[model samples]
Target: MTTEAVLDIAVQALMVAAKLCAPVLVTALVIGLVVSLVQSMTQVQEVTLSFVPKALGAAIALVVTGHWMISTIVTFTTDLYTRMPALVGH
Candidate 1:
């Protein structure tokens, strides 16, 4: 492929990756921030407090978005597989 085509493919792949990870990452970020806030307010320096919420948040996110995540990954994989020959100049 040409340089422009390669870059375009890379960009598209990155965009898809970001989209796939967004829900989980956002959940983790929010949970971490909230837990940090609570810890600060209560002066609780326990490391477990931070970890539990983040883990729970990630689990909840996975449960809720599991289908979407699976579909997104499957679609990406299928698309890539179907285009493999063309990508390889077959």
Candidate 2:
């Protein structure tokens, strides 16, 4: 494969990874920010106070987006496989 083809594949893989991770990462970030704000306001410095909510939020995000995420990855993989023969000039 040419360098350009390799770079294209790498870029596509990175984009797919970022798309898959975005939902859960955003959920956790939002939850953590809110928990931090509440902790600062209420002076509740408990570890679980911040941890539990962010974990639950991330879990909920994953649950909600799980099907879409799976379909997206499967589609990407299928497309990559379909393109492999051409990429390899076979």
Candidate 3:
């Protein structure tokens, strides 16, 4: 493949990876922010308190988006494979 084509593919792969991870990451971010606010308000400051909620939120996000995530990855992989021959000048 040409240099530009290889870079394009790499960028696309990165975008796909970011899209796949966004849900869980956002969930954790929001949960951590809320937990931080609560801890600040109540002065509880328990590290585990922040961790548990974030973990649960991430787990929930993964569960909810699991099917979509799998389908997206599968589609990306299938498309990549289908385009390989052309990319390889076959």
Query: Please, what are the lDDT tens digits per residue for candidate 1 over residues 1-90?
Result: 567767877887898899988998999999899889999999999999999889999999999999998898889879878877877787
How high is the lDDT of residue 14 in model 1?
94
Ranking by lDDT: 2, 3, 1
Better of 2 and 3 by lDDT: 2
lDDT winner between 1 and 3, please give it: 3
Return the TM-score for each candidate structure.
Answer: 0.86, 0.97, 0.97
lDDT (10s digit) by residue, model 2, range 1-90? 789989998999999999999999999999999999999999989999999998899999999999999999999999999989999998
- Which stretches of model 3 miss by more than 4 angstroms? none
Weakest 10 consecutive residues of candidate 3 by summed lDDT? 1-10
Best by lDDT: 2
Model 1 spans with C-alpha error above 4 angstroms: none
